[model samples]
Target chain A: MNISDFQTRFGFEAMYDGYVDAEVLGGYTSDLLSDVMSKAGEASTLVTIQAHKNTVAVATLVGINSIIICNSRPVSAEMIESAKAEGIALFRTDKTQFEVSGLLYCALRDAKA
Target chain B: MDIPINTEGGSRVILELIYSLKVRDVMTRKLVTASADTGMREVQQLMRDNGITGIPIVERTRLLGIVSIGDLLKALDQGQMAEPAASHMSASVVTLEEEMPLTFAISYLNRYEFRRFPVLDKTGSLAGIITASDIIKTLLVEMNREVERLEATIAHPQTIDPAASPGLDPGSAGTPEEIVLSLSFPTRQYDFDGAGKASAEFKKALKQLGIEASIVRRAAIASYELELNQVIHSTGGVMEYILRGGRITIVARDQGPGIADVQAALTEGFSTANNWIRSLGFGAGLGLPNAKRSGDDFSIDSAPGRGTTVCVTLNYAAGP
Candidate 1:
């Protein structure tokens, strides 16, 4: 599934759409940036409530192509700017991190099938 | 002359200098002395001729007492100008060892009413004398030198070429490659907005250098964790990145209320961050451990009063 698919399929609001629309192979759910940095897979969509610039930085470092800011956590303009600069797709949702993670898991599994 | 510097709360450089410098470093070695039989009138002459406020009464380098200008004045007023130096000289004196740290001298100056202290060598011989003025002068000179060094570093930032670096054998590399990148960024305390800037810059530079993606990820993780540690834990500090010899070295140095227990700090799930800091999706106690896990080599040096310095080295050849 491509990064744009997360916005269209799951109805996640795209905060920054300047990214490359790369393939999202999987997903990792965590609020802790360090945990995400160490464990998140390559080209994964990060499902977390951490809507900040540091989150974008961590995603860039760990090869996370897209971030889904769950729980409607307020995404700062700086975060959107950073995401745009780093070419990482940013999205927001009213769903919690667990709900987003579950939905991403089902969607990724069905896409792989 | 009471030195107005607060020994406990002074800047890290000053505090480190004070603690590192010995009493002998700041003491006046040129001695002017009077014997027990030296007349009070002669003491007065010595004080006038040499422009000295005090003179130690010594016998073959053994310190006995000191005669000050005040004692000479008392002798002149009481018709005792002809009396021996020992009779009026203050016998009980507080002395400092030549090897004692400069902080001892500073504390002694604050504790004692005397203007100077006689510095003694290991053999119990009078080596020198230290006054407040001497300490002040030395510290000022050293601080000036330190400032100049910092300015020079700022003027010409280091971008080291691996070929020119000494002690690195060129034959060790499979192919002669020129690796050049050294950068430093200053990090402030609680500056969450600017916390990961250094790591982002490091990632960009590493990517530009054509380093392997997995290795770059490790380096980025290590630098980010260490950077965030400084922002959350230290007063402020600098994060330095050096890429040379097929290796990336990240150093985080801080002016600190240093870690009291470094072993516990390295353990996962041990954080000293406040509640609000934890609310920002940090303070998970995984910072140091994650940094350690990412790097090929890790070392941390810290103490309660001294600042903390953490160095992480990642080899480009090392697998993720």
Candidate 2:
């Protein structure tokens, strides 16, 4: 399923309130930039809370589908602005990291089914 | 809670505090090396004797390439096993420098689907070689060290200032889960041959941040599936993550046609994916469901004309 389908099915509120017309890739969750760089392949979705620009550089290098900040944490304005500038779909979640990952896994499974 | 302690600690005491650690701290410095001219029979014997799967093929200490058991066997397929090692060895060797941080090394190994790699010097000389087994050993050693340090700390909890502790320092033997970190990235759809790049990036990030192997694998699989989903289902999308408080979460969003039926899509055998998707070794209808099974929690929201969003969470439970 696509990002819009995820929002509607899981009742996720858009972080930026803007229309993002991207397709759903896959998910990655790790804080290690080297690992992300070498492993997170191109055009795949990533799930990470590391908001550094280095993250953006790696994402740009590997070319992810979007980014999701979990753990009920808030994305810095600078990060959000940068994401927009880079044309990345930035999001935030009130759910705990566990909750967000679990929900996404289920949805992806549901879609696969 | 103060107590007297000795320099040496008990194993149980150490193991209790060192569980769930990573392999970045104790990677072997003694990297094995070999020559490209080495015969396949000799290489096979060396591997069997040393219990190794790979070796860096060097020329006058310069890293020319590498040879693995698989490479040797592949040569055998063409009746070339009797030939020189250079003729059968992999030409484009993936390598790492000795000075590179362990995180980078781990990421390189995990991301490339390679079981072993050569380490090179500035002059292109072979320094050593690292393998998946070596990394695993490193992790084990680090865990042991952490356990020892933790036992010492616990034995004299009052003498050490908790506030002054270097949280999650691998060299200092701190707990693995003590680190607080965050990461982000963008997804692009440049071409078909370039697909799976985003997920690869995400895996690299995790390796750099020092996540465990199992965790990285789960994340990689999920990301790869989503990337293939993008190539098969839509024009493109993005995937991102966050790591904190003993859990990692993954999110994928895209501007593609939404799923028609959430229930039908969630099933195992059903697939709207085309034959092209299957041709690429995906679209077996296992991507989404496999991701859900691998994660602690999974959720998705999509509309018929709107885009799609996916979220996945991985919880590294405390006190495991």
lDDT winner among the candidates? 1
lDDT of 2 by residue, B159-266 (tens): 666633323223634545444444444343322334555666677777776777677767766666666565457545666666667777777777767888977777
Against the true structure, candidate 2 has what lDDT?
0.61
Residue by residue across A1-113, what tens digits does model 1's lDDT show?
A: 88888777889999965668888899999988878988999999999988888898889888999999988989989899989988889999999988988888998998999
Best by DockQ: 1
Q: Candidate 1 on B23-125: residue-level lDDT in tens? A: 8999999989999999998998998888889999999999999998787889889999999999989888899888666777888899788898999987789
- Poorest 10 consecutive residues of model 1 chain B by lDDT? B163-172
Q: TM-score of B chain for each model?
A: 0.51, 0.41
Q: Where does model 2 exceed 4 Å of error?
A: A1-113, B1-34, B159-320
TM-score of each: 0.59, 0.36
Candidate 2's docking class is incorrect
Best by TM-score: 1
**Residue A3 lDDT, candidate 2, scale 0-100:** 69
Model 1, stretches more than 4 Å misplaced?
Answer: B1-179, B318-320
